[model samples]
Target: MNLKILTLDEFSRIDFINLVNKVFEDYTVPIKWDVVSFQLDVKENSISLSDSFVFLKDNIPFGFIVVSIRKEKARIDAMGVIKEERGTGAASYILEHTVNYLKWRGIRKIQLEVVKDDIRAYKFYEKHGFREKRLLYSMILKKTINQEINYRYFPVEPRTAYIQALEIYFNGRKPNWQREPISLLLSDNRYNFTKIVTNSGEGYLVWGKLEKENVPIIDIVAKNNYTDILKASINFLKSQTNCKNILISSVPEDDYLYQPLKKVSFQSILTQSEMEKEIF
Candidate 1:
């Protein structure tokens, strides 16, 4: 089969969005076409249009790869091949082209995340020399409206400088790319940050609005003896907003807050593997 690859700019934004949404129609998370969201992702991850690509057969798009270049590192922000085009060597060809393209651009490392349950993708990356680095999780907490919050806390605006400083003493492993400090800083300013002080130390939580008035906790940090700080922060969030549930994503399994998150009624809803490859 004669295959052609096009730069992301080859198609208009709407056309490109349609192609991606079609290719990922069955993805674990539904992908929607929103210019604002797409632009935010590009800005947050420093994605360059030159590094993004689309694969075509007969001049029709069948696969695509979204890449973000950061100095010596490159990340596969997203990649997909249409369902009908799978098993035809299209994915392999696209991967090869993308890797070579990155290498030519002086990218020494490439990283991506695969849903743990996506056996095919997991094996595909492993077969292509990607090493599974760590487990990242999306956890959720649900509660009744009648429940009461006993702990007192207050909300504050999320500041990049403050988060950068707190990261120095943060005991948890770094989260996946999207939840990292840089991503948070690039995110819209609507997110709410909260702090809790206890005899032991100080803990912080960053949360944002979600559908149905739900609040998704973006990141949390607490000291060893201040695990209860997670509880207080949640209570503070509940008291401030009419959020019905709380969702947290990309939490490392080994993080100090992981166990405490579970104790606060958070349960794992999804899991992904952060994978990386070194290409000199």
Candidate 2:
């Protein structure tokens, strides 16, 4: 079978909304398109959190996958072959070629997660040399705006006090990725610097939109009442007239806010188990 691989930019040009919507149209006798995982269908700018490749056959898209590759390692973010095309070798061929492509790029170890319950995904990744890395837990809040969450969002620059608040809650020197973005937001008046307040002090969502969707990329930082701060921030986003979704990245598994998120209407769509392999 002849296969074509497109970069994230190329995939965005195609009408993928319908393709993905069809995949999740049926759950158990209901059309639940919104139930699709946030990572699977995202805008071009949204997917820039990392590099991704999409696969096609005969000038048509049967299925596609996304991966994040660094110099030393790579991760399979999400992958699927359309039901009709399954067992037709599309998945195997893509997986084999993609790994080689990465290997040639100097990425030694590749990783991904199979929903602990999805036997087929488990076998698929295993057959392709992905090991059981870690059991990842995912949570979401569907109905978070029901209650008036008691937290304040300040439209202010991420000052020292604000960064200090984050240090206390998240308990670390802020990662460079986050700080740089916050710094950028601070100097730019156009970017909305939304901060949340709690008894534990304050947290920040250094975000704003550069595109059609209101989903400003979240560079979340909190100190003290981590859970409360995040809940407040999320609720605020839900109330926004501008953005439809909030995309939080690189949140840790043991985050204090994880449990609270479960209590809300959030769903566990999928998890990316952390895995590793050495090339040399």
Candidate 3:
């Protein structure tokens, strides 16, 4: 069995997309990527093709690890091996190579998230020196918020919202890779920001539509009065889109928005473990 790894930059864009879709076809949540979305992900996540790797067995690509870099920190945005290549040690080999490469590039830390119930994947990361740091919840509000909204929501620039969030809301919190400040800045134009000012305090909502029926709340940061701000945001979103559900993905358990999301009837549909490894 001959196995070799190559950086993603070495592969054609079409080939990389096809290989990723094939490798993740049977993943926990099957992923299908086209050129546009793939390119958008690359841009928004700061995915480093030079550092990302693909593993080929006998010249056929069967495994991949997509890495996103931000300064000295990095995240494994996605990694998978095709079903046919499972148990062939291809995944491990790819990860080992990628980690060594990242360390050599002066990365201080690496992070990734795995489904909480995916014992096999979790064990694989654990075996490779990744430790669970926190639990991230994918919360959803299915039913429309029937309560009347009294507060007015004003549209604000992404930079304005981000600056306020950084100062007050995300100051001491640990947000996941996608919700990091840099990620928000990278994808700023893709989302709309709304600010709600109340007697108690002010809050901002960062939201956008990924699909017709699904509205993703990318980030909701507030100085005080989370419930009112969240309710107003939901009501505004409901008025704007034909979305069937409002979702907030990968919310850390310790996040200020977590409890408020539950208070506003957002149920946890999925849970993931945020894992990390410190590179020396």
Highest lDDT, which number? 3
Q: Put down candidate 3 lDDT per residue, 1-280, tens digits, no spaces.
A: 7877788899778998998888777777667889888877888799999988887778888888899999999999989888887897878888998899899999999999999999999999999999999999998999666545577778888788778767763468677788766676777578888887655667888998748688988888787778878888787788888677999899999887889899989999999999999999
Name the runs in model 2 displaced over 4 angstroms: 1-12, 15-61, 140-151, 156-193, 206-220, 231-252, 259-280
Query: In candidate 3, what residue range of length 10 has the lowest lDDT sum?
Result: 143-152
Per-residue lDDT of model 1, residues 111-204, tens digit only? 9988999998899999999999989888888872433334545666566424743574464446566656666666656466667665556667
* TM-scores for the candidates: 0.87, 0.58, 0.94
lDDT of 2 at 174: 29
Candidate 1 — what's its lDDT? Answer: 0.76
Error of 2 at 45 (Å): 7.8
Q: Which ten residues in a row have the lowest lDDT in candidate 1?
A: 144-153
Q: Give the TM-score comparing model 3 with the true structure, all chains together.
A: 0.94
- The best-first sequence of candidates by lDDT reads 3, 1, 2
Clashing pairs in 2: 140-266, 141-266, 142-265, 142-266, 169-223, 169-224, 214-243
Compare candidates 2 and 3 on TM-score and give the better one: 3
Which residue pairs collide in model 1, if any?
Answer: none
Off by over 4 Å in 1: 144-157, 160-166, 169-173, 222-226
Query: How far in Å is the alpha carbon of 265 misplaced in model 1?
Result: 2.5
lDDT of each: 0.76, 0.55, 0.85
